[model samples]
Every structure is written in structure tokens, then in C-alpha cells.
Target: MPLLRLLCATLLLAAAAHACRDGGTSGEPPPAGGGGGGGGDGGGDGGGGGGAPTTPGWIERARENFEGGALPASAFAPDPVPDDGPFSDGGAYFTSRGVTPPAAFRATQPFGKDGWLTVESYSRRGDARLADHAEVVADPAGGANHVLRLRSQQHTDGTVVRPTAPLPSRYRVSLRAGFPAFGDGEAGGNNGYDAGDETAGPWWPEERAASQNGFYWLTILDALPRPHNNTWIHHHRKVVIDSDNHHPAWMETWTGDEFVWSGEHPIMMIALDGSRPGDVKTGNAFFSWSNGAWQPSGAIRAVDAYLPDRWYRVTIERDGPRYTLEVSGTFRYGGEGTYRAEIDAAQRCVWHYPVDAAEAAGAAGCVDEGAFVEGHPRWPAGGAWPDWFMFGDPHVNYYEGEVYYDDVVLEVWRD
Candidate 1:
């Protein structure tokens, strides 16, 4: 078997043995944090003093109506046999946070309010088994005072949580996330696996190192409309940050280790379409690891950089097929500033060209050339809006890192 396939088969086997864990294996550092209030003012139909008003009735009633629900014991069956794959790599990792859909909570609709839904109860798939590492703790800043923290030690695991109800199509989601200072083995290092060992024989030298590169992601996902089979489509919009450039070729093949950014910067991306499971075409919008700064992805770029160890308000808004993302805080590149982008959904398509085609003609042999390809579309034509949204890292691997999230709020606009 080819090295890539062999590695994948090994991961699948590993996933089958365990429930999904969260953590990332690719990308560059995220921005530093130290400022207050960044992002564009919510406008269009939901415009207001503080953007669209929070979805009413969601905040006050979420705990009462949404909390305490758990997945069926059957839903927790070993990897791949359950409703979704048992492994935590793709949509399964995101949807499996607390309760799988089709359940009572999964069917709960928005309260028809224009306010925001606040998620207070957070859970992970193997928290009970990994209690020593994954947990929800009080935020040092106080107020609602709770935050979800995920730490990994020889394993690339993470935590996830979902709102009590589904989010509206036209909505703004906001949250605060933080990362610790980079350390050896925290970002990029072999996870104590000897390269020549029998167990490591299936992986390439680079794969072994890259697989242990510690990283984290803050993501938002939605179920796509499957008019073809009346099924569900899973897609992700995520912010990825790695500790260093030592990532697997499969994860960062287009850029490679040479372009790996410092752990302090974060890359924002949206995955639209692809052929393989969880193989969505990823497009970078507002950050780059190549230069250790925020640069434009197409016509969009970050006005400022992000910092580590500090908290910054990250917000995402969708208007029609266009998405506007904003980040505000102290940055290493642009100083106390805000970064923003206005992107169309069609811009996130993954492009393919004939190999051996000339560069002048725009063909670079099957390669992922970034986002905003003019003609290709990620979503199926005339597809319906997504029915669900999820947050957290879904890729499965073994690495070590920590990430924290707090003050998560999602607001929808109803006609």
C-alpha cells in the first residue's frame, strides 16, 4: 500500500479502537491577543447597535431546555459502527460533542427570537475516560465564569460543545479563545515514538514527526443539504494554528514545513467541497503562516495580527452567500487592531487542473491552490441551507497542546 493510504488505514484502525479526540496536525501559528472588541458591526437585515441583537429566549432558556441531554448508550458504540464514524476525525467529531442529532435536543428549533443562544454546558466524547486531561473550569476573568479547556499529552485530543438548538442561516457567532506559549513538543515534536520501531514502520519519517506536531482549532460546521439522497452533508469553517512547521505532508502538503508559521499566529479557513470524506476544499481568508503575519487571501487580509496568552473576541457572520469574519486584539503584526474579511461562499471552492499543464495556463497538475477560484462551487447548485452547526476540532491524531474557549454566543436573524 502507498504510504499515505497505509497511514490512513492505521489512523482508521486507531479510531475504531477509541472514540474521537480533538486536535490539529497542520497549519501555522495564530495571532497574539491583547486588545478589546474587534470585528465588523453586524449590518444588513440584522444590523443594530451591537450588530444583530442576540437571538431572544435562547440565552435564558438554553440551560433549562438544552442541558442534561446525552447521547444514547448505543450511540457511543465503538468507532465507525454508530450513526456516524466512531473515530473523531471528520463530522463525527463535531456532531458527537454532546448529543447526536435526531434526538430531542437535536430536533429543537430556534425559539423564533432574534437574540443569541449561549452554550454553558460543554462535553467531550471521552472526557470520562480522559478526565485527567480534558475539563471545564472557571474563567479567571469571572462573570459567567466558566471555560472549557482541553490538554493533550502523548495524544492529540480536544473538547467540543454545541448549542441546545440549531442556529439560523443568517446569524453571527462569537467566542473568545486563547492558547499557551509554545514549548518543545507542545507544537512540533515526535510524540515519543521511535522512528525505527515496529509500530512506526507503517509511517514515513516525515509523517511520524508531523503527526506529533501539536496544534488546535476553533471551528464552526454545518450539515449540508443532500438533495440527491435526502441525506446530510458535513462541512467545516475553521481557524487553525500549529506550534511549528513540522506538519505531515498530507495535512500541509501544498505549503510544507518551509512555510510553517510561529505558534503565535492563526490561519482562518472555510471548507466547501471535496471528494473524500472530510476532504473539503480549504481556503485561507485572513492569515498566513509563511511570513509570520496576516496577509490577504485573494482580496481579503487581516488588518492586524493575533497574540497568544490573551483573549480576543472572534466573530463570524453570514449574509446571503457571503461571509464576513472579524478578529480584534493585540497582534504582533498590526498592533492593537482589528482584522476583517468579506468573502463569498463560492470563493471557497477547491480547484483542480490537469497535471503537466503550464503555469501560464493556470494548471499545476492536481494541487490545492488556495481559495476564491472563479468558477468552481463548493456547495451543490440550488442546495438548501445547512440544518445544523458544530464547533471544535475533529481531526484524529496523537499530539499535545491546550486551548481555551469562553463567552460563546450565536445570534440568528428571522424574517
Candidate 2:
């Protein structure tokens, strides 16, 4: 089975989200020259500079993992939450097609009730329940009738909620989020076992390969593969916008201490596969992970800023291949910033036949078989678009913390 399916199955059976291991931490700050900032054409070949320094070593390691057979079994853990109840009160709106813009297709959730949200634990170090970490209670701050309360206890936990229907091509998603003022000090060590405090958290052991310590994440799952021979193409396609409370560089291995505090930074990332301008897969070819491999197409860092006990509005809009992410509010660090990224599908590349076919033909034929070709007609079918939106720490591990979310709105465009 594919890695993602296996993960979902495991979580379904186990009744908790605990796939993947915790990442190790190093006391050293992310190497110099790693800061990310500034904005330009989101599709430019130039790597976004001025934020966190690039961690080439970590990237290389992730590449190796992608190429080296399947992701580690250790990486395929279970999500603690169950898929129960409706994702939204507005049914059938998500699947309605061709309804043009200015026309609103919204799924608003206030979190005042309990049936709409599903919470799961994503850590392996300790025993924690989704209910223990998440709750739908009256807002003490008196902003809304009910708010989604998420707490990161000894492990990194998350919650998943889908829309009433699939999202349209052009739409705006806005939500109010705040990190409550609470401190838990430090807890774990550097060797993948230590759960750091509010400042030191964990990252996905299988991807990115680092921790953000004390931060919040809102991930949107855009595309998913259909049930067919070529399903891997849609797996793991999503956008991740995270607030990095503790700036840590990606590590090549799990060999560092947990308490190293770097600083604070906010990041936006898009994960996809596509060829570069000068790559062999030019023309009609586009990138596809048919063989179960993925690469980060873009990682843009926003201004390094965030404040506790303050509410901020985060909006993510997708139009065609372009995505615009913005954050605003008193606690917002990047200001009323607009960051864009365009995915050039024409530059995608795909291998002909399978790796085994090339291997059977010897070195010369192997090279020919491995060559990039035009993407299939069904390359980016409707199944490859986002259908759900989620919040909280999906795949990161942390010691302890609390986050609050309210007033989520999803708006669809006509033109």
C-alpha cells in the first residue's frame, strides 16, 4: 500500500495519529546564511533568500530517503483521531462544480459544538489522548460563542476537518488563530526522545526533518490520487504555513540536543514535483510522483514576527497554479504581507515505463527508460486538487503548549 494510505489505515485501526518518529535536535543555531525574507515572482528559479538559512544537508537527506525505496515503516504511524461526523453543516456545496465567482461557497465553523472536529495525537514519546489535548468550549476571551482549543501535551497532536464539499479553483480561506500565554519550560533531550518545552518542538521525522518547538500550523490538503494504477501522483500534495517559535535548521540525522533555542520565524511551504526550466522534462512533460516520491517545489519565509495572546487573521487563496498567503493582526509578525507562488506544470518530468523496465534493458536502455517524458493526459485530474482544510500540528512533535482557533471562513470565487 502507499505510505499515506497505510498511515490512514493504521490510524483508523489504532484510533490515534502516531505515525512517524520524533526528530532529534541540536543545540547549535541553524547555520548562518539561512535567513529567508523578501518577495519576488513566486515562480522565479532564484531560491527565496533572507529568511532561515538553507539547510542543504537536510535537503540531501530527504532526497535520499525519497529515492531509497519506500519511506521507513517507522515513518508510517497512525493519527489518533477518527473520521466521524460531517465536515461542515453546508452539505453538497463542496462538490458543486462550475459555480463562478462573487458567488460565495462558504463553510463557516465556530467550534462552539463538538460534532464538527476530529482530534488526533501525533507523538510516540508519551501517552496522550486527542480529547485530552483538544476541546470545544466557551471562549474565555469572549470573542465567539465557542472556539477550538488545541493543546500540545507530551506529544504533538492535531485536528482534521474537511469542507462540506470540494473547494472551487479560486477561493479564499480565512481563520483567526491565537497562541495562549502559557509556558511549560523544556522537557526532552536531543536524541529524538526528548520533548522540548513551549519553545522547542518537533518536526516530521519523514519530511523537512526538523522541529519548530513552540509554534502553530495550518495545513491544507489540496490533491489526492484516485483509486487506480497511478494513485501515487496525488498523495502528499498540500500547503503548510507554520509559525516557527524556535528557529532550528533541518538536520541530516537525529543527533542533537533538544533545548537549543534559535529564534522565531514564520514560513509558508508548497510540496509538489515539477521540472526546472532547463531540466530534461521540458515541453508537455510535468512532474508526477507516480513512483511514490516527492520534492519540495517551494519554501518561502515571511517576516520573522509573532506575539502571544493576540489574534491574527490568516488567509490563503489559490487561483489556478498561483497561491497567495497573507497574515494580519496584532500578533502578526510579517505585517499585512502577500506572498505568492506559481506552479509551472509544463516543466514537469516523468520517467517512462518503470524503474525495473529500464534496469532490465541494461545501462543504455536503462538511461533511455529513465529519461523524462510528457506527462500523461490524466496527469492532473480533478482528483489532484485540494478537498479539505486542516489545522493544528499534523505531523510535528512537541513537549506542551496551547493554541486557539475561531471564525474560519471559506469563500469561493466565480471568475
Candidate 3:
């Protein structure tokens, strides 16, 4: 297990019991407030102008606040999206204050016009449980600097409240999140965890059954700020999984931690071994993750593989099993001929819960990595992969463990 350490260049140790306050882990320092805002014009398909509100439908322009040298008011230029409304993160973007999505922002699916993005103070999985609450506050011009805030037992048992919607290809996303009670990673010295990464893979450790932490939160995928900087498209979301699992206790970092300049498809995922379940997604190929193993994505000249979590980037572009897997932007694995055209790339696939090993084994033969292989001591699916599993430990104060997630972008063409 990794030894728990504090952030910055400071060292302050305390007992796990009294180390944190009610909202965060014990012994952690409070996060510093007051950040600076930058100056930039808004950018996006949706653009317009600002002045005194004359029409009834058009929303009123917003005023800027520059307490500690932030952006000035004139920076709030108006640019209406073509038929598209104002961009938004989740529901209420700000937690410290009662904020709402700009009038231009509206729901696209489920119930359009009806408020789709919302915020709350708490949530639960089963019965009457008090989890933390969160909200999102969008910037006036639909630019960056969107904020999020949440607190309480919401940190335990996979209790989460997030907004889901279709997204664009180019944009920048950022957030300012913190825990009031604990410093950062000080609650479950031996057992807390949280993370924000791609929504693909088993929820537990590389090998484990349930979550050691009680709760978790993160913005999976979001839009980039404007002024149309190509770099905004590639910046990935940050994932944190806090738990009271391993001995010494620590936190997990995912692929989205790095800031990219541009790319397609933005997605994020968080998990709890026992409290939450498993999830996966693939396209133009088939994939299976059970029995602690890794398998190729398709059957044609195309390819399939898990993108690397650390420094390397993995991409599998193929029409069938006869595909290629590139690591660190270089070709690491793939096939030339053999059964190339037999496998056609798939569109979509997902595994939720109540799925069994036999069902997992029956899904596909593509996942055969060490973690999902047979005879692996920690393979929770028993010799096969199940869609979902449980999360959380009642007796433990925090669910703690390590989680690694990486995001991969695929660009495929057939032969």
C-alpha cells in the first residue's frame, strides 16, 4: 500500500479519527479560496451580443466581478448559439451561492425545455441516506471558469449527482472542487478513494470486490471555454476517488489529468468496488472484461486494447480483428492478415449489474488481461466478467483504494 502523504511541500500528520472535520478527512488543511479570472472573448457555435435587454425572450447581459483582479464587466460580450442554447456544465454550476444555468441553456433530450441540469445538497443509493449535494454554475458568455461545490457523506458509497447530455468536439473544461472537513487525502488513512476518468472498466481495484470508501464525485466530460483555442478540445476532465481502503490510504489519478489541445469524444468515469458497479464502452469492435484478462476489440484488420493509464496513449483503429493497437502514439500491437475482415467494428456495449461470470465469459473473448484472467485471486467475477458489483464497507469509516483510468480516442478506416 502507498504511504499517505499531504499535498504541496508540507507535512502534517494526525490520527485518522480526529484528523478531519465533518466534510473532509481529518488533519487536512482547508483549500485556499479566491482565484483569478482571465480576459478573453467567448467562442462557440452559439454567439450573439449584449446591451440593455429590449426583447422579452433574450436574456439580460451579466455583470462581471473583479474582486482580486478578475475579468472586467465589458468582457461579458453576448454571442447567441445558432438554435443551440447557452452551454452549461451540470445544473446549478456554483455551490457557494444559489446559481442557475443561464436562460439560454436548456435540456436537449428526455424532457427538453424542462430544467435538465439540477443541484442538490445530498443524495443516497438505497433508502434514507444523506449523501453530499453539488451544483454547476455556467459563465455568462458560456466560456470557462465554470465552478462546482459539494459536501458531506456524499463522499461515501458511490452516491453521486451529475448531468448527462450530448457534447461537441472542441471545447475546454475546468473545475474548482474541495472538501471542507479533510485536507484532501486525510480521511480514511487506510481506506478512502475517489476518481474521475473514462467510464470504462470494472469499478474495483485492478483486483478487488468492493469499495473501501463511502462516497465519491467528479465531472465526467464537459465543454471547453471559448475564444476557440484548439487546445481547449484536448484538455481532459480530472477524476478523484477518495476511500478508506488500503493501509496508509491515498487517492487515484486518471488519464483526464493531462490537458490536451484538441480531440474528439470526451468521457469520464468513477467507481466503488462494493458500493458501485462496473461499466465499459466500445465502437467498431467487440470487447469483454471478465476473468482478469484483456482481449482484442474486433476480428478484422482493425484492433482493440486498453489505452495506457500512465504516460502512454493507446488507440485501436480497425474494421475487424486484423487491426492495430498503438501505444504512446506508436504501434505496439495489431494484426496484418489472418482473420482480418471477419470482425466488424461494433457500435456500442455496456455491462451494468446482476451479470454473471458465465454471462461475462459468454459476452466475448477479447478481455484476457492479468486482472481479469482465470485463477487470479482478486477477480471478483469469479472466472468470468459480470456487468456490475456492490460497493462500500459499513464498519470502516472510509472506503479506501487505488484506481487508474485512461481515455483513448479512436479514428478508424477499413481496408
Candidate 4:
């Protein structure tokens, strides 16, 4: 089906979006949170003159804490869809959280009024499993305060927790997430994987390092704060499958990592009015990983360093032409502190209006190229392109780990 816009805070609907595949690999990456409150105006002293209506700083809002727990279990088996083959560096991770239909199609109200959330998952075999307790559990983090959890085992077998509704075009979202145990890539170093075997030559240098380091987008899409627009996520209704699989010729044959962003009535993020980003920097836009978490960057600044079990309160927002990223978590170095940066065009978050500034900049060292959208670019879907936020690994090849999520809030600036 399409990217449904069903925002019901109180009602419940059990459904799923099917991106059917017939096995084999190859493709590109695919990509909500919660609730509301009035701001700026506080309850002043009861004066003789009535105070003006307390205006909310945000024009629209949606949030999810998973406190009410999950809705009743609902199982879905998507009917087989046509095969369309692989997307750019595609690996078979297709997911959408809270995959409910539109208000007219299902019972829905404004976003976040619904205290419950829904989850849907798919494998490459055109088979789908929806609403399994093991996949999504509320309050698994050991608090009556509650939290949302998503876990994936297979390389390409992942799930998503869709929200009751969508966030506004221009919005600020905040959430807490944790990767309990990120595998250490250095086999012979410390942590005791091979113990004393200093010569661990199982994988290629790049593959070994990449495998040890969990990815922000290589697996999980839209888990943290990033810019979004009409070009949210584009999935094919009919997935293409190549009978004779072979490794692509690499950089010389590099056409684009976003080949899946094109072709036919693809599902997700495509506006009803027909708008797609000419550039491939919106969803799965690149960032640098350092000092544990994947720090926001203009160009690619990645070293396959390892990540241990840790938690952080992550906030990514777009205010006008500037993007702000703030992360705070307990670290081995200085315990807990906040690291924030407000990025603009000068930082090379993007090169030129066209993405040709230096396509092959990786030859030297990775340069800041792609960037997140500066503001909430409108999507005709009645909300953001996806109109949903995902909370688990959505890619098949790289990371297969658990992500703990809580207290998600999405907001639209009043301006």
C-alpha cells in the first residue's frame, strides 16, 4: 500500500506495508515518535484581566512513550509482490513503524492521542511477521516509566515500530536510544574474542572493521535525528530479483547508491503530488562516526572503531537554514556530558546545489558532502514523507543488533 497517514491517539488498527521480495540480495537503504503539551505561556498569577490564549511553540506535535504498552497482537502475511531487483548497495531491509492506513481507511484521530504503537517486519522471501512480542516489547528496560525495544537477528531480517501519526514538515524530535553491546572489530585486541590469537585473518581488513562497528544507516534508518523531506523512503511495489548474482564492479562501476530511489509506483515518501529529490542526500544521508556514537558530520569521517554497551539522549533538529545535533550519554572518559553542534551550508554538509562538488572526494580522505535537509520540506502525503519513525535495524547486510528506544517526541516549529 501507500505511506498511510492514520493518526489516532486513542483508536487502534492492526495492519502492515508489504515490500515483497523473492529471495537473493542487493538494494539501497530504506527509512516516529511521540506526544504533546503547550509551551511559552505559563499559568500566571490569577489576575483581574484574563490572560491571552497560551499559544504552543509548535504548530503540530506527535509523541510516543509506549507507556500504555502495545496494542493486541496482530499477525500479517503480505501477499506476494512483483520482484524489482536491488537498489543502491541494497541489502533487503524494508520496514515501517506503526504501519496503519489513512483515517478514512481506518479509525484515526490526530497523532499521538493513541497511547499504543504497532510493529511490522519482513524477510527477503516475500514473507512478513507482524506484532510479535519478541520483536517489540514495552517496558523491557525495567521501568514503569516504559520504553520501546526492537531486535533483529538475521542479516536482513529486521522490524520497525510505526507511530499512530506523522510529524509536521518542519519539526524537532528528541529520543533516547542505546546499543547495549556493540561488537569489537579488533579480534586480537583486548575484549577476549580470540583471546591470544593476534593473527585473526578471517575477513578482509575493511570488512572486519566494518563488521565490528555497528552502523547508523548501514542497518538502522531514521533511528536518530536527521533532515527529512518528500524524498523520505522509496520502495518498489514489485521487487526485482537477479537470477545470477555477482558482486558489482566497485567504484569504476559506481552509478549511485540510490538506484532504488527511482522507478515505478514505489512505496513510501513519494508525494501524492509527485516530488522526488534529484539528489540522494536526504534519507540515509552520510555522517561521521567517532568517540563511540555516530556523530553528525557534513562529509564522511568514519573509522570502523568499535562501540561498547552505552546509552545517549539524542536530539537532531532543523531550525530554518541551520541544523542542530546534541548528544549526551555516559562515557568511559568523562562520565556524562552533552556534545552539540549547529551546522549550516558553510560546513560542506553539502557541496553545491548540484551534488557534483567532488563526487570522488573519498580518494583522498572522506570529505563532507551530503547533508540533511535544512527545514521540513513539505511532502504532499499530508505530513512528512514517511510520516513515520523507525526504531530498529532496517538493512540486511551490516548490523544485526538490538536498539532500545524511549521518550520520543516530534515537533513542528510555529515560526
**What would the TM-scores of all predictions be?**
0.48, 0.44, 0.25, 0.48
Writing each residue's lDDT as its tens digit, candidate 4 over 299-345 gives 32222111244556666555542445555666433346664544442
Misplaced by over 4 Å in model 3 are: 1-132, 135-148, 154-161, 169-171, 179-246, 249-415
TM-score quality measure for candidate 4: 0.48
lDDT of 2 by residue, 158-231 (tens): 33344434555555666777765323222233312233322221111332212344333454554321110011
lDDT of 1 at 342: 56
Off by over 4 Å in 4: 1-60, 79-118, 124-141, 162-166, 188-310, 345-389
Q: Tens digits of per-residue lDDT for model 3 on 1-415?
A: 1344444223443444344545455455545432222222211122223443333222111111111221111111122322211111111112113433122211111111122222212112233222122223332224554433233332322212222232111111211122212122223332222342211111111332122222222222122211111111112111112222222232222222323221111111221121111222111122322112223333111121122121222222222212222223211122121111111211122211113444344334333233211332222333332111111111111222222111111111211
Between candidates 1 and 3, the one scoring higher on lDDT is 1
Error of 4 at 61 (Å): 1.8
Ranking by lDDT: 2, 1, 4, 3
Give per-residue CA lDDT, model 1, range 52-138, as digits (tens): 454432121112111122221212112331233221132343333442322110111221123223221111243324233334565
How big is the positional error of residue 339 in model 1, measured in Å on the Cα after superposition?
1.0
Question: By the lDDT metric, which is better: model 2 or model 3?
Answer: 2
lDDT agreement with native, every candidate: 0.36, 0.36, 0.22, 0.33
